[model samples]
Structure formats: C-alpha cells, structure tokens
Target chain A: MRLLKIIIKNYKLLDDNFSLEFIPKGRKNIEDKEFELNQIDDNLYTFATMAVIGKNASGKTTTLEALAIAYDILSNFKIKHSLNEIKNNNKTISLELYFYYNKYLYYYKTDLGYEPINDFVSFKNEELYNCFYYKSYSNDIFNLDKYSKIINNTVLPDDTSIIYTILNKITMRGLYYWSDFELSYDIDKIIEIYKTLDTNMLSVVVNLLDEHIKDIKRENNNKFMILYNDNTQEVKTKKELFSMLSSGTTKGLFLYIQIITAMLSGADVLVDEIEIHFQRTLIDNIINLFKDKSINKYHSTLIFSTHYPELLDLTSRTDNIIICKQNKKRIIVENMYDYNLRSDSIKSKKLYENYFNTAINYETLMNLKKELMQEIK
Target chain B: MKYLIMCEGPNEKAVVNLLLDNNLLIFNRNDLLGLDIYHARQLVPYLVNLINSYNCSNLKIIRIGDKFTDKLKIPESIKHIIDYKQILKCHTHPELEILLIIDKNLFDKFNKEKSKIKAKDFAKKHISLNGHLYDNTTQFWNDYFKNNIKNLVNDIKKCKKIGKNKKEEIYLADLLKK
Candidate 1:
C-alpha cells in the first residue's frame, strides 16, 4: 500500500485547504524536475524524502503532527484517550488520506475533532469494505503518530494490512502492532506467515546485530550489551535485536540497519528528525538508501523530517518539501509540492533556508567559540 | 589599525555626531548596518573570519545591539572563530546622553520634533554642559540632579539600567546643542 495524497484543513495554520497530490491525476507537468510528480496515477507516493522548512513558530512541525494523529485515529481501535484528549485536538481536525494499492485508490478519513463527522475508510470499487479504522491507541499496534509523516490517503484494507491474517495465528511472535494498545487483529493469522520470514530478511538483521556484537566485544570486553528489562515484555524481545555493544557505537550503526530492517518489513516507516543522534555522513548514507527506489524490496514508503541544510543537495525536487511557518496567530503550513509557487527560483532555497535560519544565532555562536578557543589552547 | 565603532540606534548616531561635533571620536554612521536590524551575534563570526579571510592581522569589527538578545541567540557551530574583539552593549543611551549634556541649541536640530526658538532658548538657560562629569560614565538625567559635573555624570550612570533599553536621541541633542 502506498499513500498518494493527503489533505490538511483547519488543523494548525494548515487551517486553509491543502493537498499533497503525489499521484497526479489528469495533470501534465513532465517538466516538474521530479520523477514522482510525473506519475499519472492518483495513488503512487514515489517521493522518498519530505523536507520541512519555515520561520520560527511556523506550522511546519504542526503539519506533521496532524498527519501522525490522523493515523493514530485509524489504526487504534480502543483508547482510553479520545482524539480531543490528544494534543491539539481541534474542534474540527479532519484528514482525507488517499492510499493507492496496486493501482486502486483507498481513502481513510477521521473527524477526530468535533461531532464525529463521516470518519470512515472507503474505496470507489464496486465492493464496499469498511473494517474498523486502523487505530494507534487501544490496539496492539504502536503507531508513532506525531513523528510519522505518512500519507493516509491510500491506507490498505484491514485484511490486507496483516501480512497474512490466518498464517501467523499459531505462533505468538512476528510483526505485531504497538503492544500497549488492545488490537483485535488476529494474532494467530499472522503467526503462520512469520515462519516464512525468520531466515530470509530476519536473519540478515540478526547478522547485522551479530556483527555489531563482535565489534563491541572486540573493543570493550565485559560491558553489558543487551540490557533486558524484566517489567517490559517488549523490551525483553527487542533487546535481542540489540547486539552486545555500546549504545553510542551501536546507535548510528544500528539505526542504518534498522532503516534497512524497516525497508524489509514492507511497512510504511515514519522517522522524525532522521538526522538525530546520527552523524551527518551516516544520515546521508541512510537517505541514499531511500533514494534508490528502483531497488526497493518491500514496497515500503519512507517519510521523514530533517534540519540539516547539507541535506538539500541530496533531494530530488522541492515537491518533497513541506514548509510550516508561524502567522500572527497560528502556524502557516503547506506542502511545497502543491503550494502553486509563482516562480521556481524563489522556492529552491526555501526548504534549506528554513532550516538554516532557525539555527543561525550569531551572538551565542560568537561567545561560545570565543570561550571554546580559550579552553582549547 | 582599522577600528570600527558601532552604535545601538539612531540616538547613538546623534550622540556620536555630537561627540564628533565636540571632536571626541573619529567614525561615521555608514560603518554600521542600516536600521540596526542585522543580528548582533552573527556579527561575531563575520568579525572572526574577516581578518584571516582577507589576510589582515589588524582587522577589527565592532557592534552595538539594542535588546536583540531577546530574539537572536548566537549559534554554536563557529565556536573557534577568533577574528575581532567585541565591544557590545557599550552606549548607555548615546542619544539621550547628548540631550542631557550637549548644548541645548544642538539638541533641537536633531530632535525630529519642532518647538519655538524662544522656548528652546529658555530650556537652554536651565541646563549647562560646563560643570558635568561622569563619575564613571555620565548619566543621561544628570542635568536635573547636579550643581556640578560629578552629580550630572553620576545621574547619567544611574539612567543606564533604566534608559539603556531606549534608543539614544543624542544626535538630536547634539544638533540642538549646536
């Protein structure tokens, strides 16, 4: 399943109507410089990176937050916390996420705001299937809604969401949604399919972990690598994913491996601040992997936010850019792909400059270096 | 050795104009950025890099920011840039200082507001720069407190905390004193 487009309305300064039309239907701009924009279908999300830029207090972060919340509304079935109880539950926060799976359009919308207006998943096909929305709360799936920048437009059907509904039933382990949520998903159905994956892609992840463990044990003799928590079942299982290694060395190496793992999982991956806790060079490496879409294995989608300006040289087009800026009262946010920019020239620097401007504090910079030089020599 | 002297605002402009009028300092307004709007902290890196980049050992850069501290913070990336010495937050109220101490006729010329010459002359008689002296740096309000220069300077120093936030109107005062 691939997200084709997203609509943000009255949520943050995205209060205005905005849509990121990834799959351009009936639109012809072959000159769009971006290969993703030239696609004819209304469902394929070909763009690998989404860079957000804006002045201070701009709706940049808010825009991503709204989309994350939208997925949370659909994926989780039961939640003690209502949509409004979540952060920034606007009186009418609604989203129409368009997903395109194998050339078919599926939409998932939720009125997490007020009055619960028409929150349903629908397809235009002759068969109308509406299994309850895929929610993030009160479900077994852990959807990191705020940080995930996914297109909800083309969400897959509930049955289609599980790798195999009937196969994974006998086994308790495989890909499960967030454990804290009470997911009614057929755990038994997915377990049988889990057996198909242990050696192929799963073993590769284990090798990466094993290699990391060897590297760590070679460097540091007795330090505990895989720290287990008795109170948390998920932690115990996830610790196996960690090699016997120091957190810092394992962190950057582990993250890139995780990116590969996510790609192998055949699921939409949402990573916020892909630049965080990683070296700039390592970030470039991860981004390079996503950019190579022709070699994509699992039919996965990658949506991420970053603040590194050196990142600009790595992107394909400004269409993948989303800017969120603050207005006098609210955050002004819109997707760069759909912004109807008058001239292409004014926008080329918009995305990176947005990141650069926030980080450009000259006064503190001067004193810090001045103090550091004194300490250095 | 080329030295740059920066003013906080337009009053600093006027005060420096007056100080130049009294033949005190040797610099001009064009030496600073217009509208006093460029960031105060960013100036540090530019200053630090300028000397080496241009291959000049005697290069200098100076700045005066009026409360830009509340919004712009200096970045930490260029922490080793050691190009120029900074004399920041220097002028107390360079403009108002001109008004408090400079001759009254010079103050009216740059005040931007107009009043009768007779009224201006009457105000001039009440204030004099002859006996004024700043115990450390003269206060902008010393004219009202002192019969001698020390009280005037002390009073001016007193206004720094209160009036430092205000734009200096000293250039106008210098014009009025003229």
Candidate 2:
C-alpha cells in the first residue's frame, strides 16, 4: 500500500491542474533504482520521501493541505465543506489519487462543483468518482462482483467512497498530517501503542529533544507524561516541556513521535511547513530518516512541503523533487529531473539554485526596486 | 556505437553538435550525448564513473577541447584516475577516445613550421586533433556545419573569417529537429 501520485485541480492555490508523481521515471541515471516497499514485492520503485519546494505564497502549504483534503475525505473526517470553497468561483474541484493497494493500482477521483442557484455545494448531489466505475447511496453500480471477495455482502453508507471501502479491506493506511505543538487528546491510546514500539523509537525522540527528556512513561494517575531530567525544573504539562525546547527541537520531537507511530501503523504522512525553525543539518537528518530505504522498514511514505533548499542536497533520486512555481494565477508543478536530465550526480542544492537562477525570472523584484528609486528621485 | 562528447564548455558542445548535424562525424544524433564540464581536472574521474555505470552495450566517449595546445598539458590529476595508460588495454567496452577540435590560431601558437608535425604527433599519441573549429561562435558553427567540413586542418585553413569572438550557443529549436 503506497501512494504513487496525486493530481489536484481547481482547489485554492492549486488552480488549473497540479500533479505530483511519487515514483522516479526511467532516464540515463537515478532512474532504474527501485525502492523495495516492505519486501511485500521486490522491484517496487516508489519514493519513500517526497519533498515539495516553492517560493513564499507559491502554494507549497496549500499543496500539502489539498492532499489532507483527499485523506480527510477518504477517512470520512468531517469538514465544514465537502471541499474548500473557491472565492466567488464555480470551477469544479477534483482530486485524483493513485495508490497501490494490495498489489493493485487504484485511481480514485472525487469532484465537487458549486451550485450557484442553490447557493451551496453538496456532496450528495454532486457526481463522485466520475470514472469508469461508481457507487451511490450505499449501492455499487458497477464492478460490484469484482469487490465481492473483500466486501463480503457488506453495504457501506452512501457517503462512504469506494476508496474508503477498499482501504478498509486491506492494510492500506490513510495519510496523517502533523504540525508544531500538536497535542493529541487521546494520549492514553498513543501510550499503549508506543509501549509496543521498540526502545530505539523512544530514544530517537528523546535524543532529538536536546536530551532533556529521559524517558516517556505512564504516571500514577494513568496519564502519559514525559519524564525529564531533574536538572530541569519540574514541568506540570506537556506544553511546559514543549516551551522549554527550541522551536526546531520541539518540532523534531513532535514529528518523530508522529513518524514512529505512523511507521508502526504503516501509514503515509503529509507535513506542511516541515522546515519551519529547523537548521539545515537537522532538516537533512529528519529527511534522511524517511529517505533512507533501509531504516524505512514499513515503507511508510513522507510527503512534506519545505522552504529549505538545503534539504534538496539530501535527496539521492531526482524524481523525489517536486518544484511548484506560480505562473500568474495558476500553479505549475514540475519534476526537477526533467529540467536538468544530467547523468552526473549533481548536488540537489546546486540544481535547485540553478533552476531558480536560470529557469525563474526575478524581473518583478528588480522593477519594483527601480520604481522605488525613481520615486525617491 | 553510443557517443558521449565530453567537453570543457558550451562552445565545444556547439561544435560537436554542428559536426554531428552535418554528418561529418561517424555518429548520429541518437548515438551522441553532450556534457558541458566546468572543471577540467574532474573530467576523467567523471568519465570513468559514467562509463562504468553506463548500461549500454556500445558506448564510446570523445574528449573535445578548445585548442590543440590545451592537450599538451594532460595533468597528473586526470592521469591518476582510471589509469589513462590502461585505456588501450581495456577493449571489452567501447574505448575512451579523444578528439581535440580547436581554432587555427592555435596552430600559429604551436609555431606554423612545426604545426603539422606537432598535430600528427598529437594524433599518433592519442593526445589531440580530429577536428579544427574556427573560433567560438554560432555563425562559425553554422557556416562550418552548412559547408560540411570533414577534414580538420583543411577546414581551419578555409573558414578563417568565422565570426566576432563570443560564447557559442546551440540553437535548441533547430537541434530538436530529428
């Protein structure tokens, strides 16, 4: 169960068409190298870590959020709207996701359009899965016989998607999004899950947290709290410990916990602003945790939006890079390898700098500076 | 055989492409790949890794240069890598080859009286000269390609009035035509 690609259209900053591939295509070099996904089947060339980069307000975060939308829709997480409403726009919102589920590739597309007359966009009325096969109102319209082996005469709710149905049938885990200072209220359940985790996972979290946290244990009151060394003043809550650590270290610990948990559950995780308050070395190390296929045992996938160009230096495969550039109102997503296509092992930092220096134009900034100079004169 | 035209900069790349386009070279467009190297010292190291890693059955690499005089200084830095001496011994793979395409002005620098002798010696020693380009400019390349200059020394003598000295750039749109 691995996410191969995601294509989003008419969703916020991801207007027009935006597509991302999670697998490297064939080329002179860095192409034939394949990633083994948990040894479930050899020769699977899926990327374990995917990084999205772009200039500020170029929709890097929006791209990750759009993925979160798809995951939420699949997991049936309630939202204010079926899809985020476009500002005074009636364009159709579509999310197409391609994932390998149970060794079979499955493409699930969901589209939502705003109804001007009714002044509302409802999921019930909109046509969902506008592809070859579809289901509506808890009924399978096409290829019901094909899914009989898994569904076993179980009928799902009308709102439940075939993707949701298929995901329930296999070990295909949904995407999990993490942020800074996010405290899960279900800490007891996490503690239970973490108790089963290897000691290496706990140590990784502690070591990344400036060595302040000695261990994580359950308190006498049946609450999960991190045990900090006595040299540090006693902290009453998780927030106190989080406050004590630098923003980068705190984010690292938070992400480490989420990643370890996700790896155990065999889930794919999406992160927005992954490089916030992190040093280049720390960012590289965090990315390597997911990029290194050997340590990524469960084949858990990580898709993150980052501003740190230095993170690019850590990537071995060119296809793992997705560059998002703003072309007027629309966002253009490009694969880094397609631009250079060099067989030489050029550092990603150099490639990224080259792309911006050559492919991208900063004429607007120069013009603005000139305009300000003229005004001063 | 697949050809990898390893060169110092864009001007050499343009010349190689021009020769390949005019059918003066022994290879076709599909059989050739170009690399614009920034550091000359890393050339052999890069080539060795490229050749060893290449999956093709038949791949021949040609090292192109800006001047015949440049080949006289084959630094110990490049010789230390992959043993330039052992290139002839290894024949299982398409052998690493060299083709120095330079300006006719370089002949004058090497001294006109001994220029032909030096050029022949470079060729015999596998040090230089299979192509003589007329300066670094697209106009020079365009004329050289259009006229179909097969012989290096003859072309260098004929196309003396090439162009104003400037960095040469390949016309990507024209080159894209199969």
Candidate 3:
C-alpha cells in the first residue's frame, strides 16, 4: 500500500488543516520521471522518498512523529500509545489519510478525542471510503459522496482504529519508525533482529563508516567480536560493542539494516533526525538505496526529517520535499512544489537563503547574545 | 481578493508600506499577500504557489519597480494556473528617489542638472529629515515620510511628467484611492 496524502488537524504543533501530499501536482516534468516515483496506476505516482526539512525547533520532528502515529494507527489497529503521547489539553485530533491498496483508493477519516473524565483517549468518529483507482480520476477520487462508503460511524473498540481493523483482515504491511531517543533503547533489540537476518550488508555498512573495523561477528551469547585492520580482535557485549564503535558507525549500521529490511518488505520507513551522526555522502547513499528501483524492488518509501538542507538537493521533484515552518506556535507544512522556483535553481541554496521563510531568526540570536552578555557581566 | 505587491528594492518597499500605513492605496494591508522585493521574473513560482495555496480567484500582482522592460514570462508549468491579465506594473520612472527630490521641492533644481547628477545623488545631498541627511536607506525614507505622508502623496502626483513616455507603464499615483 502506498500513502498518497494525509490531512492532520489540531495534532501536536501542526496548524489546523495541515495537509501533506505524496503525489506530484501541477505540470509534470519529464525529467522527474528519472526520480524514484512509484507508479501506482496509469499516470498516477507516489514518491519513493520524502524529505522533511526546516530550521531548529521548526517542527520537522513533530511532522515525522505525526506521520509515525498516523501509520501506526492505520496498520496496527491501535491508538493507545498515541493517546498516551498527548500531553496537551486538546479535546480531539482529526486525521484524513488517503492510500492506495489493491487497485483501490481508500480514504480513511477519524477523530481521536481525549476523555478527560476517564483520563483516556479514543476514536470519537470514523468514516471510510473506497474509490476505484483510475488515471483519469486524479483528485476526483477525493469526492466522498461519489464513492462507496464501506464504513461510517460504526461502533468499534475505543482504542482500535476502524480502518486498521478492516484492512488487517486482508493484510497490512507494517511501517518502521525510528527517532533519536528510540535508538539507544532499541539498540539491543535491533541487534537481535539483525542477528536473525543477513549480516553481510551490516558488515559492509560498518566498514564503510569506520574503515578501522575489518570485520564484525555476532557470537552465540549476544556478544560481538570486532576485528581491527591490525589483526586485533576483542569480544564485547552489545552495549560495549556499540559504545566501542563511533556513534556514526553504529547509527549507519542500524539505518542500513532497517532500510534493507523495509525494502525487502515494501514497508514505509519513517526516521527523524536522519542526518545525525552521519556524513553527507552516507546519507546520500541511503537515500539512493530507496531511489534505485533494482535495489528497492518492493517500492518501499523512505520518509525522513533532516536539518541539512543540502540533502534535499538529491530529490528531483519538489513534491517530495516537505518544508516545515513554525510561526506563533503553529506548525505550517508546505510542499516544496508550492514555492515558485526556477527549474535550474539549487534547492539547498534557496533554503539556505530563506526563500521559504524557514531560516532562523536573527532577532532571536541577538536576544540570546544579549542575555549571554548580561549573564557574563 | 488577494494582492501581491512586488517592490523593486527596499526603497520601493518602504514607499508601499508608507502608503499602506496611511491608507492611501485602494487595497488595505489585509488584502496584501506580502510586500516582497523579488523581481517579477524570479517571483513566478512563489506567486503560482501562493495562488494555489490560497485558492485565490481574484488575485492581482502589482509590480512596483523602476524598470518594467523585463517582462514576466510565465513558464508552461504555471501558465494555465495564472492569467497574464492579472499582472500590473507601477513604474517609478528614472528612480524611486525622485519622490525624495520632489518632497524636498528640488525637482526643478534636480531636473536642470538631471544630466549631471542622478536623483538619488541629488537627494542625498539636499534632502534631510529633522537635520539628518538622507542615507539612501529604506529606514531613512520611511522615517522621512513618516509624518509627511500628505507631502509624499503630493510629490508622487507632481512627478507625472516623469511617466510621460508611452511605455504602457502605470504610475504610483494610480494606486491611490480615488
């Protein structure tokens, strides 16, 4: 299944009526075809990778987290974890998700409300529409009344997603989500999971990041042996091995393994702070892994957030680049395609120059300097 | 209705802000998308995106610049979405500093030596606000005309001779509320 679009309202820092589109809009550039856009139907395509970019505290992580929650609710038939994450006093959060499955476009809309009385959150309202996929239909598939309403306000489990319950009967591909905080906690689990799978690519990734390591071998008792180029080997626990390796090498290894697994299963991989502890070329290679059709036969999507605008230069189409900006505590998400950009203009240059108003505020920096000077005095 | 006012430079931006501040323009500040200084050619994608985002049906683009020779070429990517008729140019002939010269009642002196000195140079030499000389900055122009908006409006009106050329150019006075 491929996600086409999602509209989130009153969720976290996102502004009301916040929408993100995965499909291309406006005039189609023939050159964009060379990019990794997966064709779902005739003339209908979804991006293989989407990059979320912005300045510090501009809600890039929030957007990724929201997508992760949306994906979890859609595929896992659960919103208990999502409810637990809500710390705000907001009464409800509404979401409208569009995805393609089995030659059909499914529109799933739901509202999750916080029950203050019981200190719980549950689905307040739900609706689902199934529209037959067609190239000519384009955006007309969004017209709810014109299509078949398979589910509407049906009473179901408070913590379960209606669409997930229905879609799970057929089979739903789960999404892989990773954040900076989850890395340390999931390191051992990820190592165990990697042990069951192929270790050749993991070794390649480890070697690519840190050339000092000649080989990495997982032993019988969850211990790892690292062989240095000088023919020195040391046995260490999972935590010790991770600590012994550079942070970049550890992250690169885990990210590569996750990407390979996602590609094999054709599931979407959502990662926040993807540029942390990695070089530019390493990030570029990871993006290309999803873009390369031969390597990614299942058309698994890679959705990641980054502070590095230069990484956006890898994308050929503007729709795949999501620019998040926070103003007055509200997060505004805009697709790069919505900006007036010259076909030949460098994406990173525009971002660095504050073309989209996503640059850091000089006034804030001055205020920080003033405070620092006062404290020093 | 949505109005996108594209200034040629910071001085033009200051003048537009002054006009908007004094409620001289027909469209109020709320009707404005923004007061940007991006050139018309470079602003196509931004404008097209704004139109798409706002779903603006009655949108007008008022280009405030000294030079209108550079035509706005709507690329094929956005031609169908934006109409060429919606774009209007308000030229500040010669330069926008002409307003400062006219405001200081030095138009005759500047016109006599127009061949010798540019209006900007003449304004820097002659015009001053509260004993402060004109520094050729947006802040200077804005402060110079802060309390003298009526004089600024009159100066724009008196500079009609500068727009005499048959170049299909509109003047700043034409934007004022009739």
RMSD in Å for all candidates: 25.7, 18.8, 22.3
Clash list (residue pairs), candidate 2? none
| CAPRI category for model 3 | incorrect
- Docking category for candidate 1? incorrect
lDDT of prediction 2 = 0.50
Tens-digit lDDT track for model 2 on A1-377?
A: 56666777777767566887666554413212322123223344556677888787677777777666665655552222334433244566776766555555455666655555655443332222222222231122223233322222444443445555556643325544444335444344444455667866676676666666676554433434555666343434544444555666655655666777666676777888776665544555555455434456777777888766655544445677777777787767777777665644544546465655323456888899999999999
The iRMS of the candidates, in order, is: 15.3, 11.7, 11.8
TM-score of 1: 0.41
Q: How big is the positional error of residue A109 in model 3, measured in Å on the Cα after superposition?
A: 1.4
The residue-by-residue lDDT of candidate 3 on A1-377, one tens digit each, is 87777898878778986888878775654334434576667787777788998888898878876786677676666654455555463547888988888888888888877777876667666888888877778756666665687844556677667776456752335444455546577687667768867778777767888999988898866688888889999999987987787767777777777787777877788888887777765676677667655567776788988888767766656778888888899999888887868766878889889898888888999999999999999
Q: Rank the candidates by DockQ, best first.
A: 2, 3, 1
Give lDDT tens digits, candidate 1, residues A286-373: 5545543333455444556555554544543556666655546765545554655443233435544443244445787899999999
Kindly give the number of clashing pairs for every candidate: 83, 0, 2
Candidate maximizing TM-score: 3
Q: Per-residue alpha-carbon lDDT of model 1 for B1-178, expressed as tens digits?
A: 4444444344343334434433334333333322112222333222222222334334334444333343223333333432424323443433343434433334445343324333223334445445643322324333333334343334344444334354422221221222
lDDT of candidate 3 over B1-178, digit per residue (tens): 7787777666787888888878898888778763332323335333444444455447777888786666766544455656667888788877889988877778889889989998788888898888988888888987888988999888888877555634666889888888
Each model's DockQ?
A: 0.01, 0.02, 0.01
